[model samples]
Target: MADRILTEEEKAAQERRGAAGGAQRGGPPHMRLGQPTEKSQNFGPSARRLLGLMAPDKVLVWAAMAFALVSVALTALGPKILGRATDLIFSGLFSKQIPANVTQEQAVEGMRAQGETKLADMLAAMEHIRPGQGVDFTAVRNVLLLALALYAVSSLLSWTQARIIVRVVNTAVYRLRRDVQAKLGRLPLSYFDSQPRGELLSRVTNDIDNIAQSLQQTLSQLLTSALTVIAMLAMMFYVSPLLAIIALVTIPISIGITAFIGKRSQVKFVQQWKSTGEVNSIVEESFTGHELVKVFGRRDEVGARFQAVNEELRDATFGAQFISGLIMPMMMFVGNLNYVIIAVVGGLRVASGSMSIGDVQAFIQYSRQFTQPLTQVASMANLMQSGVASAERVFEVLDAPEQTPDPAHPETLVDPHGRVSFEDVSFSYTPDRPLIEHLNLCVEPGQTVAIVGPTGAGKTTLVNLIMRFYEVDGGRITLDGKDITDLTRDNLRSQIGMVLQDTWLFGGTIRDNIAYGRPDASEEDILEAARATYVDRFVHSLPEGYDTVLDSEAGNISAGEKQLLTIARAFISDPALLILDEATSSVDTRTELLVQQAMANLRQDRTSFVIAHRLSTIRDADLILVMEDGRIVEQGSHAELLERGGAFARLYAAQFAGALTEDAEAGQGAVPRGVPVH
Candidate 1:
């Protein structure tokens, strides 16, 4: 099972359940789910790498930033412009109250004589005022219109900046996803053998998505927020330096709170994602192996495990959100406090004649704008942290070591005869445990070779080596006298076809499934292969015939029918070499006979290797090799091995002993050669 090619469902389960981890880290076996395997240990490097991915789109980034700057600048000037209209209203009202014949100087003198010193001072400070004039409605309307225009243009630029940022973020994320996918292909199979599948899936799917969302939401807002803060500060100082200094007092306090909370929440965010991956793994495994859990009556155990992991996720998420959630309210507190102080001080300054009422009002607005961005920055801290955490996982995939590359100039097979040779082959899954050592074998152009062995006897490993799924640790494997390593992996594998015990059919029509073996094959060829494998016999009975859509599990088809479809798929490839690994294990006696007939036709001119536990299927093979542990113990013709009564004979006898007894009691002298092993 471990040596077989993993189906999508199996890969999801086995990848994270790698046997390399001797002891689990997070909790009991079920709760562990390979937790913390994907957690980020370093934040800075990962963040820098993530930023580096955007280097290709720096032009767009700079453009967005520039637009944000101009937008913030224009927006900051709006309040000041409106302040002029405020001055106009005040001055117009006072001017209308005065007599038409009186001059501005006369009005001030009259107010002072009346003991209205503050009012006299305020009136004296007013500009462009005439004693006989009424309110200037036209001038006030012009100022209001100018202020509105500035706001409208500023909003337009802000929207443009957001659109530019959206493009930049999505492009960067798309490239990141592509690179991660390519990285997965380059990594060695052993890497998957050791890592959890669910964790990698999370990194590929969930983590990348989080990073995309974080960048999309934060990039534009943070850029604008920072610019707004700078622009507002300048406006505040321009209106009144004293009020600006008071607003600056809240900066240190806000920074202190953000830094303190951000640090704590960062750790919790890592745990939160880690637990999320674990939960995903448990659910994936439970659903993939749902039938097994029920057959074993372990549904309660699986449910309990899911609940425990879910609780862990809940706790981690709560801690992260609660701690980071403090930023907004705390920042709001400091902002409101700054607002109150600015209002009070600006009022005093206005009364002292150091500032006009209009200036005080504008300065108060500037103060609010200044602190609003600080509050926004504080609130965005959590999103940034979570995104960086997800980035770390993605970077880990990009940073993983890749498999050995193919030769710059590869060899090719000329008129290939399917001759294969193993020259002193040495291989193992681990360094400390050697499975196959100094092995050598050769097969002719067209010979059917059968291998029989007990479990863990390295039966599947031999075929895996031929496919170069794992490179030989030492020595060389050759095809037609050429070292297999000299050829590209694809070039070497193109000549071979294999059908395993566990049949894999994707979600597609029966014809589509068969065509998967040779994508370029025509419809006639697909139909011919199906007919040859007995798939046509039952497929025609279906409502859609060969066009029937198979679900993910292909549950509409029986196990034997699925097995026939896989054989048909293999048959369509029409390769020079074929491998059948316990291919008949899933079929009943009648179906097995049909499968055997199809295989016989498929194996006619190809050099075939058959790995089987039921010795009866391989009795007519040209050569039979009996194996024990990792070594071939004997090789001979089937009848010769039975006559020798050695390892092969013992295995054969054990499988058919009951059948032999029944035949003897039924008045038959001997068991027939083709009796089913089971």
Candidate 2:
């Protein structure tokens, strides 16, 4: 077959598709960060759901709100209380102007009769005034002390409310992280197959942290700000309704500014997080495939990809912050305008004697209080929007459909013989494209079956069915005459051991990595498994021997050593069934022979399924199955299939064609090239 060349655009698209596929494992299409932001459609519902995370702590939240309310009420009442001192001082000054011989009422009436109506009214409105006293220093002192006490109490309540809110936020976020972790475990393999790892990780870590911060910073402040707005409005109206009306004119304008900027900024915040996920995906993939990238000299391409996604993140974050930032200054602008208007109107009322100097003073203070909270509310819109965006992303993971649960009454596997059979099984990763169909196979308890085929020929898929990593769309598989589906996945998997082409070892001792298959294994069992797999041969050369700790990536060990350790892991389990998918592919030819010998020993009396592309590795198998496009086209011993001269013959001939010519030139028997050498 000729290789079809791709157009430039097609190549770019393919790269993007590859990047998307590499984004971890596959997940929901909407959650994929390949195309960029997945904006939350309903802000109200998302915000409500985010708040609902704190439902378990609602009692604490309500207590905090109550404290904030009382705190704000006290704060709002402070100016009014202070206004009393002003009234007392001014009233005493007016009383001293009157004659000491006249009574307080008579002085006021005489002043009114002498065409001093405004002064008479001002003096009449003053309370607790002695006719000849210049000022009552004791009353003034008491008023000052009372105002200070109210402020001190309000500060204490504010601190208490803040502390409660922080605890509630921490608790709520803790639960959210726990729920997400549990949800990830319940998700099906297919869900992970298409998802990007970095993107999902961002949701789990970055998004959750952002949620906590948003709640901690804004929840209490929002509660206090809201209450302050209410309390201040009431105080303003009580002091003078006309001035209060003038102050209210800015409320609608502030709302308009917040609504407009908040709407645009929300979209940017969504983009910011999505771009962040994409950036994470790129970095993770680049790091994981660093050697391959260096070999291919794709460093420039990777850097460009990172730069592009990072630029998107930068733009998104900038846009969100810049737009949301407009709210504060804009609100302050509206507030200042309102403040100027209220000051002018309040002063006029005081001058006309319709309102006392202290009353007008309190009214102006109330006006300032009302506008300040509105400003805070406007500024908080950014944090709320960003947090809601992250919350919705997290909610998506929690809402993903879970894998089918294990049966309520799970069947237990008895002291089992590993006789496995697939009964006309059919399956596909997607509904439109069927990969495997009507496949039937059975391996006896002690048989070693080898599966060989080209890539994408369902060789690995067959064993996966036996392990129940995925369920068949049609028919069922069985072990020991019982349907595998009836058994819990853990129970079924417990009896099988798998060593794949890719090796995985965590940051732990070599002994720990080997014992991972059966943590309950004794020290002797671990050492025995290590010896059986040839892992002991190399461990003695290392500085720490079996105790040597592997890094997270296991970079300290060679690939062949890593593969050997994985094999020892399988050996320690001593499972009834064993699966080796090109398990020796990573080792050198010398190491491969040792591994094959080790495997041979481990396979004694075990039902082992070996998937190999290196034909030499499976030549001695008791049974060999030739698969193509999801069906077994041929099945027999290696020599039997080579003599048959069919698909297996063609594959064998193609692989060893050059070596056969060299053998013929060396004067060996001119037997058919497809024939297996004994």
Candidate 3:
């Protein structure tokens, strides 16, 4: 057999064709919208899972169930009481029998006469009825009292059930939020590199909220509606099976209509959710880069892009809602159909003396009771579908594979002596594109190692390897005498500190930011660390000193100040290994000097890896590694590399050639005739 391919419209047309064919074949006509799927129809699994969340509050669950049961019982009883009253009125009117072979006109006149006589008797009875009239008023009073009691009790129980449902839902939502946050915290850094910040936020905030809404409203309503329907059906059958049969004929029809609408709504809802995420991403991008857009004179362009996403979101939402909205009207139409059928069929049965008028009336009431719950259950399908979609997205993150952890029996580096070595290590961010290859180097404890290279020369990759931010593909790296992989991530990272080219500061007081690396550090220690980084002068200049509140992302602070604060944070930790990647790149010369001084203080007992473009900064390094294309092309101290006249020497000449020319123009002494500028 060959496979068949169909476009979306073709598939829809095929469904309609199939539905028409099925109807022609004498099968039940299939509805086009709100159709339930195999996955959606089974509430057992989701219900059981939700029930487990409420297990801790067993008493509350029991109480809610008890109230719900009482409510259903009372609701069922109301119809029975009304049915009995109807039966009593008919029986009293027809106490005197009529002839079996009566003309239709004569039968109608007899019924009318009986009805007027019954009304007169009822009025006469009411005249004698009075409040505090003892037993005379007891029967009427009892009926009235029972009706009021049923209403009051059902309403109260419904309220109690509502409270319990809210409690369960709220607690479940809280736990789910916590679980998502914990998963995000544990996720590898690389996972974030591939995902957008806005998308992640949408999952956490919007998707989770959708799930919570379903739990709060939809799930409870479905369960209660199901229970009410079952109770109503059981009563209908007990009262009059034939009428119950007529009433139940509407069930399949109602379900068919709902199932059709629900199916269409589910697809729309998924599209709607996706559109919402896109809109969120666009909004987040626009707001975060508002200044960039203005500077680049692209504000209108950005606004247009945002508007496009916003309009897409609106269209998707409207489509989903339009599809879902069909459910209620379809339900009402089916319900009315059932009513008409029950009225016509039941009236014929009454006329033929096969069923009582009371039973017919009761069946009609039961029909409404039945369809009402079915309608509710159908309506809640959208919410349930939304929750399923959200759960899939959330679980996509939760179930993401994590990086392997260190072996349990692996070697430990106690009080790391700061000796580091890279042994022919090769690595690539992706398999096809190698970033670093067959590299070998060693750094001694307390030595400042300067790594110089052109852009994309693996300088940052080297620092990343030392920190074990990525695992090497082919060889090994060692800290002291132990393989870097042997140490736990926490233990290994605690021994290192870094100040990157782009400084990141979280919202907090200046004192808090400084002490971030050492949370338990005292106020004095925090202040001292800040002073060592030359951040204290800035802090004192502010009206609030160290207590000044930093807004989100440290927006209130300048870039240089942010860099200094990050330096202060790294200083407070006092790690054995330090990596500074263009740490002073953003600062002015004055701020650079303060950072250099801070760096000096921080490097006292630490091994440091410094990547610098400003060649003057690396002049005093114990060793300099010049890299290109993922390999070390030259390695030596500043003077010896200059003597080698290779990659490093050429890089040095290029950097200083202009300065040398300027010096010559100023009549400064040139390099000695025999001395090598290299």
Per-candidate TM-score against the hidden true structure: 0.90, 0.92, 0.83
Best by TM-score: 2
User: Model 2 misses residue 635 by how many Å?
Assistant: 0.8
**Regions of candidate 3 where Cα sits further than 4 Å from its true position:** 1-63, 89-137, 352-354, 409-414, 653-678
lDDT, each prediction: 0.83, 0.83, 0.73
Please give the TM-score that candidate 3 achieves against the real structure.
0.83
Task: Arrange candidates by lDDT, descending.
Answer: 2, 1, 3
lDDT for each residue of candidate 2 in 1-678, tens digit (9 for 90 to 100): 000112122234335657665444333353343233456657889888888999998899889998998999899989998888898898888768767787878987998899988777777767877877778889999999999999999999999999999999999999999999888877766555556678788889998999999999998888898899899989988888898888888888988898888989999999999888889888988998899999999999889889988999999999999999999999998888988887788777666668888898888788888888888878888899999999878887888778788999989996778998989999875576677899888889989999988877788778767877677999889998889899998888888887777788889999999989999999999999999889999999999999999999999999888988888898888888888888788779987888888888788888999988888889889899998878899999988999898888778877777777887899884656456554
Ranking by TM-score: 2, 1, 3
Locate the minimum summed-lDDT window of 10 residues in model 3: 1-10
Top model number, lDDT: 2
On residues 1-678, what C-alpha lDDT tens digit does candidate 3 reach at each position?
A: 000112122233335643553211111222111111223323345446544655777787678777888888888778776665565555534433324354334544555677754433332322222222223234445665787789789888888898887897788778878988888766654555444456678878998898888878875676578778988899889877887888888888887887778777767666777667666766786788788978999888767866876787788688878887888888888889888988998887766656666677777787788889988876776777677656656656666656676689776667887999999999876576677888888899999999998866777778777776668998999999788898887788888888887787778898888888888999888988988888987888887989899998787878889989988999998788888877888889988888888888887888988888887778778889998878898888888887777888778777778878888899994752222473
